[model samples]
Target: MENIEHLYEEYAQTVYKYLFSLSQNADLSEELTQETFYQAMKTIHHFRGECKISVWLCQIAKHLWYNEINKKNKTRSISIDDLEIPVHTGKNVEAAVLQNEEKLALFRMLHRLDEKTKEVMYLRLSGDLSFSEIGDILGQSETWARVTFYRGKQKMMKGRSEWNSD
Candidate 1:
């Protein structure tokens, strides 16, 4: 019990941030974070200490996100207006505005991707998971994951160009 408590205390914020990045909804992210910990508590006995506790918690969060996504009855894309960009330190006001605009453009492009491509990209960028790890999570080969990422990037670039042109 103490160990589980310690694990939650140490990693809850990290797990919450991860879930928030994936879900893009504060309420839903909080719910999924709670669900992740609940599932972790139920399977605590099986933890072998081979991987970091945070990694294990992330796996739970990923599973919960996948379940929630699968259960969605409507197929819809995330809206650009819905993206939340984190503030970053900048050397100048111009740089800051440029950075924010770039981030918004990227988020808008990301929203145009299919769920699987977006999932892979998010796992790669936000989770810092390697192709093999992402493939394992998504049940695909590393090559397939790489291809999906490549295609996703191409699509994002095309979308950005079109947006800029307009």
Candidate 2:
């Protein structure tokens, strides 16, 4: 019990960050994070202590996230009210503008990807899961996961280039 509490306290923020990265919605991420812990508590009795607790928790979170995403075909909407366009305080106006442009470009590129590729990218980048772990999560081979990630990155780059051309 004490050990479980300590583990949760230490890893909660990391779990939340991973969840937020995957969902991109504060409310949904928070809800899913809670769900992850709930499931973890119920299943902890089965843990073999063979892997890092963080990794196990992340796996749980990833599964829950994918389940939620599949259950809802519609993309999660980002409300304008949640947008945090950083204001430049001093000499970084040009840098800030470039950063904002990059962010918009990335967002546009992401929107162009199909669901599978997007999931690969999100799990890889946001979840920080290795190719093998991603494979397990997505039910694909590690090589397939790698291929999907590379292809998705290429697609995003191509989309970004086309957007720039336009």
Candidate 3:
């Protein structure tokens, strides 16, 4: 078994970003990330090594997010706007703003996708996970993950064109 600190050092940001993708609240995501690690620490023995450690960690994060929702008893739209976009130090502010706007529009389109596709998109784009990894994380086949992500991209493209036409 890996030490808790090593697991945390490696996967903390990924877990936090996954939570942020689900909740769209940075502070809440951060809190939940801490909670995730705490829970993982407590249940580490139960982990059967059936999937990647990152996948296991994310699964924990997802369950905590749902429990949080159940406790609140409210629904909210999923948005990825809170995820930080890297701004090059040399880039002009206007260029950065425009880039961010483009990303925001893409994220907005993602919001309109069905929940599963949106989660796949987030896992693919934000988490930088491969299709196979996403499949393992979501308990699906790699082909399914690939197809879902492809369909989601097509829908986003169509939405973007519609927005452009309007």
Q: Best by lDDT, which number?
A: 3
List TM-scores for all candidates, in order. 0.55, 0.58, 0.61
Q: Model 3: runs farther than 4 Å from truth?
A: 74-115, 123-147, 158-166
Tens-digit lDDT track of model 2 for 20-56: 7788788988899888888998999988977667778
Clashes of each: 0, 0, 0
In terms of lDDT, model 2 sits at 0.81
lDDT of each: 0.81, 0.81, 0.87
**TM-score for candidate 1, residues paired by index:** 0.55
Among these predicted structures, which one has the highest TM-score?
3
30-118, model 3: which lDDT tens digit per residue? 99999999999999999999888988999999999999999777665556995777756655877888987989898899999999999
Cα-based lDDT at residue 166, candidate 3:
98
lDDT of 1 by residue, 2-121 (tens): 876887797777778778767778899889988888899999988897766776888889899998998773666688996987566656767888887988888788888999999889
For candidate 2, the 10 contiguous residues with the lowest summed lDDT are 132-141
Indicate whether candidate 2 or candidate 3 has the larger lDDT.
3
